[model samples]
Target: MFCLVLHSHLPWLANHGRWPVGEEWLYQSWAATYLPVTAVLRRLAAEGRTRLLTLGVTPVLAAQLDDPHCLNGMHHWLGNWQLRAHEAAGMPSASHRDLGAREHRASAAALDVFETRWRHGGSAVLRELIDAETIELLGGPLAHPFQPLLDPRLRAFSLSEGLADAEARWGHTPAGIWAPECGYTPGMEIGYAAAGVSHFMVDGPALRGDTTAGRPVWDSDVVAFGRDLEVSYRVWSPKTGYPGHAAYRDFHTYDHDTGLKPARVTGRTVPSEKKAPYDPELAAVAVDQHVADFVDTVRRRLRSESERIGGPALVVAAFDTELFGHWWHEGPQWLEQVLRALPEAGIEIGTLADARARGYVGAPVELQDSSWGSGKDWRVWAGDQVQDLVQLNAEVVQTALDTIDKDRDANHHGFEGDPELRKRVHDQMLRETLLTVSSDWAFMVSKDSAAGYARDRAHKHAHALREIADAVASGRDEVARRLADGWNAADGLFPALDARRLPVRSAETAAFAGSTQ
Candidate 1:
């Protein structure tokens, strides 16, 4: 059986900004990726396909998708997309005008879909798929933090609360998770087991290069499935992938007038101005060829592994969900074709849950620290290039926890005056803390992809946390309440988040503390 996993995630960006950054990111992804992807899944479900694939929607992203603020913003963004497409049609360049017309129709269709269905929120759209059994939903930590770098207590709390959040939205708790960036450390299995997570994904190297089947981790029944990089990278890779095909629409080169992509990826070395105009017919042909090639690749891998293991083997190919319609315009179509073609090719399609339930298990193995990022290690997040951010994260988390612990202890004995106000402050502190620790900021800084923006976001959240903590500590009740209320209105994502889930200091440790002014 071949299990395809798509990890869907975006950092919490609600009310952060709009053009070229925050809300725009959410809307572009929604119009291009989520709407079309869900439409494909819905079509397949209507045709009675079950357990088609596994999708991981991080709690933070889920919250943003379901937020009324974001929903209204997305609606406006789609309307703008249609207006831009219409404007493009009047461009002097005939090629640009044709591309504009095509985009206009596409945007119009997407707008209609959003208006009729997604006007409510993404949760409603995803819940329909879950109810239809079209996809197995995988949940993750509250903010998609790098778990290996986090404090164990915070890690446990985030995982538990994240799972609960998923259950609250989807009616069913996920039995598995696409661990943030597939980052894992040796003892994380204990946390997974504690949180009732039976299965999770890891990079191929984490399993020491053997990814033919799911292996029990660290003597626990919790299963860790390794992605088959050989088959998976055929669709997307840094150097070469199907998306780089010459006939496909160029992602980087945009028509300056319309802000729409009108050129094809003529060649790796071709300059944007020199690139050829995109031809949808040619791109369609390429998608078909690529889909057939992917199906054959999976077939070969499964057959070879089955022969080597003396039985059927599992071939799991995973990728980011955004890659489909957002990064590569034809990717969603390619995916729909691949999913439908694989079944006719005699390949069994199922989710990770279905794969595990089918008894595709192996012996227990101790996994190494790994991530899906470059070097498959912790360098991307905790390396020297971003050492300052890493230290800031550690200090911020500790301070936030320490402040919460102090408040909880005082309130426990009725010493701290207003329990309700303290609780509100604590919840806002956690929200800021989680936002500060998000893996996106670290990753963007390290990769130099919007490094300044990433730094500002991290520092902004940390600053808010400090203000609230200091206000609460100084007995400035009105100041703390106002700050908390402001932040709750601005950076709010997880409405149901509870600060009590955070681990408190041990009694022995707390006894050594004295009241401070």
Candidate 2:
């Protein structure tokens, strides 16, 4: 069995910056990757493909995809793409004009798809695929926080609320999750089972490279499927990958005037000025060749593993969804072709869910703290370079949680003091708290890509949490309410996030759900 998992995510960018960093990241990935990649899935589904892959769209990213602000912005972005193509058409160079004409047609087609299928937001489109059983949607924490370092209650609350958020959008709760950062702690499977999550993805090293089957974690029913890096790295690696082929469009080179990539990757070390024009025909030929190679790779891995394991073995390849159109211009095309070619090569493809359902599982194993990051450990998120963020996360989460405890204490006393106001304030504080611990910040800082922006976002959320917590602690209800309202106007995504719904006592307001169920 072969399971391909695409973990789709972007931090909250709705009310954040626009030009170089924040919302631009969202729009580019949505336009270049999400729009086209999902279209591929939709097209394949029309041809009657079932369980094609497991797609994990984090709750935070899902919220943005369905946000009215992002919807309007994406519509405008598509229209602007058309305008830019026209600009390229009027350029002095003939080759540039050809690129313009090509982009214009592509943009026009995208605009039509956007206006028709995406006007209502991504939830509808994804829900259609889910209802059709074309893909298994994996849910994650509400804000993509690093789970291993997160507070236990906060982790549980985030997971439950994240699943609830997905249920609200698609009318189906996910039984599997692509745990944020693929981050896991030793005893976390108990929480997974509690949240009704039966399976999740982990790095290959987490299973010590014996990743031929899903392994039950620590005697629990919850299963951990390790990515088969031997197969996965063939599609994306440092020294070699299909995306680096000379015929594929160069993701790094851009025609700045028209904001389009017009050159093929002539060579790895070739300068931008020396690159050749992108030819779609040549790219198509390369995709075919790469698809054949990948099929052979998977076939050999399966044959070897089946012999070694004494039975059929599962090969799981997991990657970021943005790798396709956003980071690799010919990625969507290659993906479509590969999906078609794999089955024709006598390969059986299904999702992680199908693997478990069919008993493609191994004996229980006690897993260690692991991530798909540097050294397959927590260094990217918890390294010495990011010590400040690690400390800040601890302080922010503790403060937000303490405020909730203080609120509970007030209710314990005679002065219950505006139940609705207290709930609203605590909920917003928790919201900011979740944003503060997002793994993106530490990741960016560690990788030195937009490090300043990452630090600013983390500090900004931490400041908001502190300000609101201080207001509530000082007995300033009106000030706290104002801050909560203002923050909600900016950071609000999950409408069902409530302080009462957190892992709180049943007598407080309502019973904590999925904790004991």
Tens digits of per-residue lDDT for model 2, 1-517: 9989999999999879988898889989998899999999999999999999999999999999999999999999889999999999999899989999999999999898889999989999999999999999999889999998877788889999999999999999999999988999987898899999999999999999999999999989999999999999999975689899999999889898888889999899999989999999999999889988999999999999999999999999999999999999888988999899999989999999999999899999899999999889999999999999988998888788778887767756445454444378888999999999999999999999999999999999999999999999999989999999999998878878977766753442222222222
Error of 1 at 371 (Å): 0.9
lDDT of each: 0.88, 0.91
Q: What lDDT score is found at residue 305 in candidate 1?
A: 91
How many clashes show up per model? 0, 0
What tens digits encode model 1's per-residue C-alpha lDDT throughout 172-242? 89999999989999889988998999999998888887888899999899999999999999999768899
State how far residue 378 of model 1 sits from its true place (Å).
Answer: 0.3
Candidate 1 lands at a TM-score of 0.96
TM-score of each: 0.96, 0.96
**How much is 103 displaced in model 2, in angstroms?**
0.7
